[model samples]
Target: MAVNQMKNRMQALGLLDRSFKAASDDDLGDALERLDDEHREALESFVDEVSVDGVRAGVRTGRIDGGMEAIAAIVTDAALADTIEQLGDHAESPSSEQLREVLPGVVERHRLGVTRIMLAGTVVGEAPASAIIRDLLKNDETLALPPAPEVEIAPLLDTSKRSSDEQAELRAKRKAAKAAKKDAERARRAQSAAARGR
Candidate 1:
């Protein structure tokens, strides 16, 4: 993909946000740690997508040394050897430049390891990519989702003990209501088309 397209995708994924860029390592770590399971899953999935896209782009541009096989070998080798973790300590905050260098490797290792085990039937005794990335970056300062809004749900009817005849009558009424709703919707659409034509 084009550079602009990749950049746009990153922005849409919240990878290029100013808040994330400006956030301190400690702040990032705290934010990441606080994420609920749902948010954590989302973050991991997004990271994997971004990592794969980055690799593909590198391959297309001839920036990366080889095809995916070579990339996988490099990541797997690094993961098995524990070089990625040794690159930096979990407690030490890495600079953005350092993160740029290390994030891809971490993501690729996790993704390929899982794929190898599940699809290729090869065992990969490696830690999850999210864990590695969390350890390395210690950042999630701007990724929190807002609390869900409260909702009140009320039942429209209580039909626990309705007779067969009553049930049939209720079904007929529902069918008629649905048909009426569809007619109203069609009329509204026709009016909208007529207005647009004018």
Candidate 2:
């Protein structure tokens, strides 16, 4: 058989399994250190060959789509939150100008991907960043999470107005209602059973 066919036959028969072994971190490091200069240089070159676009594309694979407000929370503090509040209805979304002003600081500080910078600017400031922010936001390759979900809040109950006696009465009424419901259910079941028997 040809050498290629012979190697394929060996692989099919599991002989290739003996050619590789899992190594511990220390053992791998020692092996690398022991390599000759030429071999080490080749490995370094392979590492250096990774491109920014490749990294960015990899990050984009996990990108999530949502409103910008969450992005703002990650990159901004109380001052920025207050700034957003001051914008009133406009605060619902960040403007491009706000993004231009704030995104560089956010990107530099957080090491976020370009989409996050865009989101932070629009969500927190109600605008997208200018070219300045866009430029700064590019070339980043870090993985990022989706924004926080908006929570629905209910108004607090004012219990101070109710007297102790009234509170006790309310609890008693609730207990009575629950007992009545159980009695009514039992009666309904009894009627069904009687009808079936007849």
Off by over 4 Å in 1: 1-149, 155-160
Q: What's model 1's lDDT at 104?
A: 52
Tens-place lDDT per residue, model 2, 128-148, is 332332333333233223323
Question: Clash pairs of candidate 1?
Answer: 28-139, 28-140, 29-138, 29-139
lDDT of 1 by residue, 1-198 (tens): 699766543432231122223334443343344445655443342233324344333223221111222233332342333434644663244444554465456435433222221111111112234333323222433222222345789868779789999999999999999999788767755653553354
lDDT of each structure?
A: 0.38, 0.38
TM-score of structure candidate 2 = 0.21
Question: lDDT value for candidate 1?
Answer: 0.38
